[model samples]
Target: MVSEKENAHFSELEKLVESIKQRQQVVIFPPGIASFIAVNILLIASFITFFAPVMTIIGDDWEMSQKAGGQFLVILLAVICIVPPAILITRGKKNLQRWFILLSSALAFMAALMVVVGLTMNNEAIAYQSPPLYVCIITSSLAAFLAQTSHYKTLTLFYYLLHKHE
Candidate 1:
């Protein structure tokens, strides 16, 4: 009953879904490599964001109490968002890749909370600064989401590669 065009469209949709499902496939990698990659990116980004600006502000005679707290907030956000997922991935936790994407979203929400608190309580007009409050929020959210999802994806791929032994 399906028209030729409808059949082709259905076929394309099927392929797309399969591709998404493939994200769940766990492929094997050298031990520690996956975690190393993920953690290094996170740590490097955190260090750059934290010390670089704070040091710059210090060198430029900016108020230490004013900027230090905001920098601390930013680093705290990064750590909270990054560390749990990294630990989960590194430890090879079961179903981590399957569920932690959603789980770490809680950390993302917490990171957002820090930004809001920073803006309100810090008395430094922390919102809408360059890189902006919202952008920082979005960046932290994206990092947390990506870390958990990618770790999950990597685990899935790793499982698929190991399936033959079972």
Candidate 2:
């Protein structure tokens, strides 16, 4: 027969496993505003990447080299914006949340840096204002915030599960 201490330990282990299973199903912002905004931003970024070449061709002002460079930049931005959310949707791995946070923070930082550079550079080509600049800043900021929250939640849950019985 199992002693009282052994039975209690087994019960605690079972509870811990159950808690982990439940937490795995708990997503931070499913079908929520944060996720909606992130998805829309990602879609917009993709659309821009897809149509940028067409826009460059239709508009004669941009030279071939500039058009190519712009297209490359758009593609890079699209990928950076896409990866985190895609991972969250596909894998939902908790340890990878730090990467999402970093990517989103980088996007937000790039947006802010663009604004600062435009304001300080005093160059007409770079100083022009666009609505998408604000959109990028806002969306990236939201994504970063959401990712951070998810990371913290995961950590808290992990720690609770590990130490609650002690």
Candidate 3:
């Protein structure tokens, strides 16, 4: 026969398990469709950025090789900030949404840094690009915020689902 204290402990444990099971059923906000679209846009932008340099090189414009090389490096940085999140989302790994947020944040930071650098250098070409860069920064920041919020909600649900009493 179970002792009184043992029975009480078992009861408490049962309640805890039940609570976790209930939490496991909690509704999570699915990843925002808008954020997914924004990620795609970022990916596309990175691709465009990447190809811009290649196109210049192919144009037999040797004079702009230095500029093209710099653009290529920037494009590579953008790819670093974009591709992983796209892959994670495409694979339906909601648990990794935080990576989306981090990548988006990095993109936004890079855009802002580009703006600052352009202003500091007073380069007309860079200044001309600032408006588009600003737009990108805004969208990327929005995507990051959405991804972070969704990730937390999903994380809670994921935790409970994994820990639910079987």
Candidate 4:
């Protein structure tokens, strides 16, 4: 039912698809290393963010403590977002990197939003002036980006090595 040209075109398409399937079958590394490193950096950043001077109002003074309560809650929220995915990644569950990538991106977004909202509420012009705010935003964003591209990074490395002779 097809012309000779059509038959040759379909054969070329089939070869390309088969090549992709072979590339995918070449799995040399364990999947979680990139995610693990990203999570480690995130954990450290979250710790620093929690203890940063964003809570300047926290003190023996009742009013100051009360005012800082909101800041404390924001830090808690950031930590909560940080910890669960770290736990999930560290637990070594199958296919958890996919979930970790989603969580990492969400954490980055949430942390950035928290920084923006806090800066706006405090009338601060620059997030960089606030250690916790900017650090959380920057580190979470970096970690999310790394987590998302980990697969391609790993695959690209191995693919290069495998085909370098060709």
lDDT of each: 0.49, 0.55, 0.59, 0.55
List candidate 3 segments past 4 Å from native: 1-95, 155-166
lDDT by residue for model 2 (113-143), tens: 7667767877443345434555666766766
Best by TM-score: 2
TM-score of each: 0.36, 0.51, 0.49, 0.44
Q: Is candidate 1 or 4 superior in lDDT? A: 4
Worst 10 residues of 1 by lDDT: 125-134
In candidate 4, where is summed lDDT lowest over 10 consecutive residues? 152-161
Candidate 1 structure lDDT = 0.49
User: Relative to the unseen true structure, what is the Cα RMSD of model 3?
Assistant: 9.7
Candidates in order: C-alpha RMSD to true structure: 10.4, 9.6, 9.7, 10.7
Q: Model 3: number of clashes?
A: 0
User: Residue 95's C-alpha lDDT in candidate 2?
Assistant: 48
After superposition of all CA atoms, the RMSD between model 4 and the true structure is 10.7
Candidate numbers, best TM-score first, in rank order: 2, 3, 4, 1
lDDT by residue for model 3 (1-166), tens: 9799856755664565466556753333355445465655764563453344334434445557676676676677666666775565444455556666676677678778877877998966666667667776777776677666644444433434435443
